[model samples]
Target: MKDTLLDLQDIQKSYDATPVLAGVSVTLSAGETLALTGESGSGKSTLLHLAGGLDQPDAGRVLLHGQDIGQMDDTARAEARRLHIGLIFQQFNLVPSLTVGSNIALQARLAGRHDAAFCTTLGHRLGLSDLTTRYPEQLSGGQQQRVAIARALAPKPALILADEPTGNLDEDTGDAVLSLLLDLVSETGAGLLMVTHSPRLAGRLSRRIHLSRGALAAA
Candidate 1:
């Protein structure tokens, strides 16, 4: 049987009395890629935040590898995020002061799992080896996003949460970057939960769920 990597059970969230996610539930397994899609106000990003331990659900449980992350203390939650989860954002949040190599190795180093050889391999695979010493400002949008992907995969985390990872690029660049992200995720055998507005992009994943009316529906 496939190992369950993340489980969201009846998740509920609110922002200052406005409900965002209402009793939404989902599960992702190891090496699986799941696309999350919805309208602008449908709570897709809220669900992703909850899943990544960046925010807590007002009700229900978030289990990572069968452990209830919601029950963990703040420090524990941060540790859990660092050690078991990798996040890629639409903005490509690479550190401006760090070189490509440092940016890629940052999370792994924080998680105490830095592997020099593996990081080198990732750089080569991402077509970033030649640019490792370059800063984020020196690269184009596509190259920057590639660095973000390399950083996320460096830790070999159990799950990867990507929110509109290709949103900043042109269509062709976005497609190519998305394909590379998927291939790298598959190579690492980590579960992927991606939020995207494009159905074309969503269709590339193994499975997809749509959020609407603050709840989940089949895509």
Candidate 2:
């Protein structure tokens, strides 16, 4: 059997008196792509954050590669996330001062996994090769998102967590970017857990889960 890249067991989280996720359990196997779809305020991003070790659940366990993230201290969790997980956000969280190439290589360099040739090739694949010398501000929304994708995949992480990564782009651009992302993820054999509101996009993945009122259901 293939090893599970990510597992969330009976997760519960709340902000003050308001609940976000409740009894949410999910699992992703190696190289599988899972799409999480739900309406806004459905706790989709909350689940992704806990799975990536960026946030802790009030109750339950988050495991990555059979290791319990909830058992690790803050520093340990940070290290685990940095070394094993790739994150993509709708905001295109790139360093404004860094050129496109530097931004693409940032996470890989931090993980001590930077490969200049691989990053260069990724830039080309994402259609950002010509923009390598420019800063994030100089690129269009789609270009910036491509750089973000390059940064996330450059490290060759075992799991990729994305929160509406293409939400900021137009329909056409978002579709193109999604295609490139899926192709590259397959090439790298990484497990992808993505949150999106688009049913069309969700159907593109291998499996789909829906979150409703802090509970998970099969889509």
- Per-candidate TM-score against the hidden true structure: 0.92, 0.95
Q: Supply the global lDDT for candidate 1.
A: 0.90
Clashing pairs in 1: none
Model 1: how large is the Cα RMSD against the reference? Answer: 1.7
lDDT (Cα, tens digit) per residue for candidate 2, span 1-219: 777889999999999989999899999998899999988899998999899898889999999999999879999999998899999987788999999999999999999999999999888877788999999899888789889988998999989999998887788878887887788678877899999989999989999999998998656
Question: Candidate 2: how large is its RMSD?
Answer: 1.4
What are the lDDT figures for the candidates, one per model? 0.90, 0.90
Query: Which pairs clash (backbone N, Cα, C closer than 3 Å) in model 2?
Result: none
Task: Give Cα distance to truth, residue 59, candidate 2, Å.
Answer: 0.4
